[model samples]
Target: MALLITKRCINCDMCEPECPNQAISMGDEIYQIDADRCTECVGHYDTPTCQQVCPIDNTIIIDPQHIEAREALWEKFVVMHHPV
Candidate 1:
């Protein structure tokens, strides 16, 4: 599943640089995750890098609207990084 930056985000600017998929970007008020590019770091890390780097607990959570299984996420990752 993709991740969502909640209102609790402090805009610390930590997550944007840590996202291996480059999915996080500055939004109007906080960082936003591009669901199409977000694979929860499946191809890069064991856990979501944004979640790991976020200072505020629960600031980054699963995107309920873009819910996806692990296999789906892996496929997305492969398509994005492998591109073969």
Candidate 2:
């Protein structure tokens, strides 16, 4: 499943670079994760990078939208931001 960055994000910029898929971004008042692009480090890392880097516990909620499988996630990612 993908990860969701909640309001607890301190804008520390730590989790932003930790995301392997580059899904995390600085939002208007907090950090946001691109659900479609977020693989939860499935095809990349051993664990979720954002969750690992985020100092604030529970701030980054994994599977918040409940896309548990990687195949489904890849499809969504491809469709969301593809080179057309």
Candidate 3:
């Protein structure tokens, strides 16, 4: 599933550069994730780069309705301009 960024983001810009998909971006007040571009770091790394760099725990989670198979997620990211 795609990951979602909560309002707890501190706008530190820490997570943005860590995102392999370039899915995370600076929002008006917090960071936002573009689901279409997010791959949860499926292929590029062993874990989600954004989550690892996130200072706020639990800020990123699987989108219940957008559950995606790991392989499919990797494929999607591979097709995009993102790294994952």
Identify the candidate with maximal lDDT.
1
Candidate 3: deviation at residue 68, Å?
Answer: 1.0
Model 1: colliding residue pairs: none
Candidate 3, run of 10 with poorest lDDT: 75-84
Order the candidate numbers by lDDT, best to worst: 1, 3, 2
Clashes of each: 0, 0, 0
User: Candidate 1 overall Cα lDDT vs. reference?
Assistant: 0.93
Report the Cα lDDT for candidate 2: 0.78
Superposition error at 40 for model 3 (Å): 0.4
Cα misplacement distance, residue 82 of candidate 3 (Å): 9.8
List the lowest-lDDT window of 10 residues for candidate 1.
43-52
lDDT of 1 by residue, 13-68 (tens): 99999998999999988889999999999988888988998989999999999999
lDDT of 2 by residue, 1-84 (tens): 878888878888999887767888888899888876887776566778788888889998875556667778666656655745
Tell me which of candidates 2 and 3 scores higher on TM-score: 3
Candidate 2, which segments miss by more than 4 Å at Cα? 74-84
- Candidate lDDT scores, in order, read 0.93, 0.78, 0.83
2 or 3, greater by lDDT:
3
Off-target runs (Cα >4 Å) in candidate 3 are 81-84
